[model samples]
Target chain A: MPEERRLRIPGLKDRIPAACDFVMHAARSAGLDERAVHHCQLAVDEAVTNIIEHGYRGDGLNQSIEIICRAERDRFVIVVVDDGPPFDPLWQSDPDPLASMEDREPGGWGIYFIKKVMDEVVYTDEAGRNSLMMVKHVQDAPRLENLRDHVALKVSVSNPVDDIWLFAPHGRLDARLCPGLDRLMTDKLEAGKCLLVLDLGDVEYVSSMGLKTMVSLWQRARECQGNLVLAAVQTRVHEVLQIIGLDLVFQIFPTPNEAAAALDNPPA
Target chain B: MLDINVSAREQVTLIEVRGRVDSANADQLGEALTREIESGHTQIVLDLAGVEYMSSAGLREIVSALKRAKRGPEAGDVRIAQPSYRVREVLEMAGLDTVLQIFPTQMEAVGSY
Candidate 1:
């Protein structure tokens, strides 16, 4: 993993590529694959471009851009700062990339792309400067090796009833937390503990990768003739599930206790 | 950046792309396919199995190609062949899977044209 660094440079369009170059070096040094590198590059480029083009009105020659980056074992975090006007990039309506080309005007598409490519993006303006912080979790297996060390995922196991083990993972189940969740849950299933319920009540957000982890774990549990189910899904979380069409795949329960009880009854 | 390798199979020309196709590199791909269309090679298949990750920007280029390909008198068409799992996810997520002609292999794609 590369050490975190901060760079202050002029916010110019030509300087956007240089910012991407700096991001690529950090991503590559952190052992991110080319795919991840491209994600990091495009995201940073867009952020910088927006700050220069929209925020500073293309004449950011005097204004300075502050870039802070961190390439950890499992995730890359970048924060771009511009001493420009206070404008919320995320406030724009997201363009549906699926919209027909004739109907697709270039309105807020870059912001949409940045939001889609990165795992998390937050914008804040303070002290007369605009700041955009973005995070992207590495997807390769190599990053998985040290994932637990980098991101702390609290997985608490409780045998609430006989023949059933309930695993409650606390915090965001985004890309940084999936590897740890996968290792912990899969280890238990492989150890012959078949019936398990993953309590996502504490999980803030579940990325597409997180859903993939849950699906794979479900597949593994089913392969061994055991059961794995989701418990106490939050409304936002369930909405995400519906978006990816995973709601049709999993058996959802209202509470962990209900889920445990349904271990015998099973949800219809 | 996108790595594109264009190959010929009878009247159909296959463009094998091997890299990430995002906003940064999608225009290059559009230009590559546009050149193919300009050269009267309308029957085209884009092999996306080598593409590891594709964002909506990549989907935009494919849509651009599809729109341009439809305009010609030959009524040439563009098809997708052997898209990777991630690529297919993006295609389906963006509702382009049904719009684009997808085949399991380049042979199938070439045969369709």
Candidate 2:
């Protein structure tokens, strides 16, 4: 099924939220998951904010944004079209997080987060406007038995018992829910088990509160002589880690299973 | 667009901003502040209670005003009061909250100065 929606709101910052709300409702009605809907909203926010801030330059020329949603059997596709400059947001260099706050830069994180959240992100300049297409897979609904009964985070521990693996998260870790994950990790660390594998497969977005939770967990694990390892990180999160040079600080694996296996056998 | 209402009491200049602060009308805010500052009013309190949303570009205007005030001969300070949560988040994200003195109430903001 294909449905198209368009909004022309003068390219002003105030209208961004309304635009985001419209996209979210459309995406949800298209049968996307809540997490996926949030991702789409964030992507739209970042892209449209860029257009309003950088593209229109406050010209008040009634800058326009168009959202197109197409639902397939297993995936939903959402496209954002803006009559902005010929800039490809995907090509922008990820900011260096290691740089001091004074030297650190603003922006660039939004696009990066969009890439991380959506399953696929593509950018193109068509007919003098920028188009960003984001795809999200609609997984079969979780089985009743597998559904989380409570609000607790369901952490999958992959590593063996002897070696230690750590999960280190960086970026905007909001205070509301991250502490729950941190507490779960700390509980495992206190058990004196060394091998730990962190499943960062689902974490692409975070805030300052989330960052603190990660650091706190890392310190707790270190105190127990257990090592921290990160796996399945999105490019933007990885860039932040690398900029801070934390890529050197934490052992990384491409997947949680790989991290778990590495914990099982020490490289000698 | 931003609607501004100015109220002058003693030496304090209170500017109330209504509606959204985006790229569309951020310049108007800067102009208003510049006109006030040019009119020899140094102590300024901006009431953002009416502002529902603000973006980074809108935030730049406020920052610009702060910079202009700092550089002005009068050495005036621009303070924001009663900012909405969304506006407050943008300010915090941009790290402007630390650079500008923000108060929760207009009376407190004006009384402090």
Candidate 3:
């Protein structure tokens, strides 16, 4: 495989959607799963938005944001380069997310979300330009199981149950955490268990890239004679879902457990 | 670049956020707002209408100004006017619209201040 694709767009908000589409297409052509493709898309958005807003100061006429997507054996690397003033996005240390919204400041959450979503984040400010590199591992291959401690937000599979959980993750489902969700959903769907429940209790936002992943996963689940269900969706996520009209396609629930139970005995 | 224009009605600070607002320039806008606040200006308006986009860094500047106005000794008030649609979307997404008062017209914002 050539293993890489590159694009350069003028620093403008209008170009952001095209830039994201280019990355999504590249990832799909590289044989990456839909979720992984979505992760790359959001990562590209966050990076390019930074470049357009901060790098060129929204001067679409002046500067440009460059994106490069490279596929590795196990991971995909997306590099965003800009020729704006020297600024390193990786060095930004986020203040405590747990702080109260009032006491807490408003900015810096974009980079924080980017760091949290990607597995590995690297930044460089060489030659008075900024380069942010994000990496996400591919989850198509069957892998060994490691007995890791279960974290609250970490996605994992329980026993071989028939229910499908379609977690319509809102917010920035960026490069950091998409792989985990992809792995969990794919593993369960591949096992032919159809009972699904998506916990969206915490998802308040989702990028277009994230939406694409959810659609692909829904298709995969349908192919297996199973269906995916969403639960406890916040208004913000629900709005986007409704905008795309996926809300009508997927079975929605009020809670994760409810969706899981309904999957066990779907209404005729 | 920091560009400040004052009138008898209000002090309008137009901080052109050129680059990403990460930690680097996060304080640049905040400092500009604070300087205006300290100079005995109670009624202030920020014209982010020129700002093509904003991130958490740029958002922090707005929040900082809001807090300063709220805590000022003389009941200082700050209003944001003419934020771009993208900026407005982000603010609504983050629920900052509920926290910060937004105005569509600079005249409305200035009048409020």
**Which candidate tops TM-score?**
1
After TM-score superposition, the amount by which residue A182's alpha carbon in candidate 1 deviates from its true location, in angstroms, is 27
The order of the candidates by DockQ, greatest first, is 3, 2, 1
Off by over 4 Å in 2: A1-4, A7-65, A69-78, A83-85, A90-122, A125-129, A133-268
Best by DockQ: 3
Candidate 3 has a DockQ of 0.14
TM score of chain A per candidate: 0.53, 0.48, 0.50
Candidate 3 lDDT over B1-113, as tens digits, reads: 43444444535433333333333355677887788788767567776676554555567677778777767787776677888765675565445776667889777777674
Whole-model lDDT, model 3 = 0.64
iRMSD per prediction, in order: 6.7, 7.7, 8.0
The 10-residue segment with the lowest total lDDT in model 3 chain A: A144-153
- Looking at candidate 1, what is the lDDT of residue A210? 89
Interface RMSD of 1: 6.7
Lowest lDDT block of 10, candidate 2 chain A: A143-152
For model 2 the TM-score comes to 0.50
lDDT: the better of candidates 1 and 3? 1
Task: Tell me the spans in candidate 3 whose CA falls farther than 4 Å from its real position.
Answer: A1-3, A6-67, A70-101, A106-108, A111-268, B1-24
Q: What is candidate 2's lDDT per residue for A43-155, written digit by digit as tens? A: 67777777766777766356677777677666566777788777666546554324433443433455554554455555544556677776665663221121112121222
